[model samples]
Target: MKAVNEQEIRASFANCSKGEAKRLALPRDLAEQPWDDLDFLGWRDPGAPDRGYLVTERGGEVVGVALRLSARQRGHLHRGMCSLCLTTHPGSGVSLMTARRAGQAGRDSNSVGVYVCTDLACPLYVRGKKLPDLGGRLEETLTVEEQIDRTRAKLSAFLDKVLA
Candidate 1:
């Protein structure tokens, strides 16, 4: 994925109002991020842990979405899996991240949710650049490239739901 600037990131949001996107916090270290290794840029708000953001390229256009963590607290005893990267994490390593639907559906208070890594680092986990909190990532028959593609597909599907 190509590195994007703050203006592109803010303007790419499809599911939130422009004012909201303008006000939301962006990652401070955009220049330091591993852009070459990312399929999408995702981060939780430091000032508001429950708020998160994702930005990526879709059909040659940069697109973004705002996410909110579910109200339910996760237990730290059992293992959980990220729906996007298929990485197995122990306890609170995964979360139910949700996004409001775009346009009228969002106005109607509709949203979609997916189980993802709590820190939203799917690309790193898929590439072995990052590891789960408790156990190591699950071994898979697919190559790293294949896993990355799979993760992108899953995320695209989720985005499709939101954009629809």
Candidate 2:
């Protein structure tokens, strides 16, 4: 990630309220982040372990969210098919991760599912990591960009539901 200022950070949140956006936690060492390897930025909060955040660039604009990591499942290894990236594994280490509802004040959803790389890197996906022959598993002819777009839109919709 770049050394983003408050304004630059705020601009990433397109649909969230100002109050909620103001409370988002930023990376401590933004300048040192491996931006070139990330498809987007995502993290688990050290202070509130269940809390998390995600920021992605779609259509040349930044879209960010304050998320939460809900209940954990033990020994559940990641197959490396990113729910967010729609990219399958390439023998690289990756994992399936989940997040809690950000603005969820009520209503029964304890968690949301996400497939994150074991390395917590999005740049690899963004730059298009080489995948081990998915072989008709993805079920479509769309390009990588289209897959990313669909995943992002799904995430945005999920956030809206949480806030609403």
TM-score of every candidate: 0.97, 0.53
Kindly report which residue stretches of model 1 are placed more than 4 angstroms away from their true locations once superposed: none
Query: Against the true structure, candidate 2 has what lDDT?
Result: 0.55
| Deviation in Å, model 1, residue 159 alpha carbon | 0.6
Per-residue CA lDDT of candidate 1, range 1-164, in tens? Answer: 89999999999999999999999999999988999999999999999989999999999999999999987876778888899998888887888999999999999999999999989999999998997778567778889999999999999999999999
Once fitted onto the true fold, the runs of candidate 2 whose alpha carbons sit more than 4 angstroms away are 1-4, 76-81, 85-112, 125-164
Instruction: For candidate 1, list the clashing residue pairs, or say none.
Output: none
* Global local distance difference test of model 1: 0.93
The C-alpha lDDT values of all candidates are: 0.93, 0.55
**How many collisions per candidate?**
0, 10
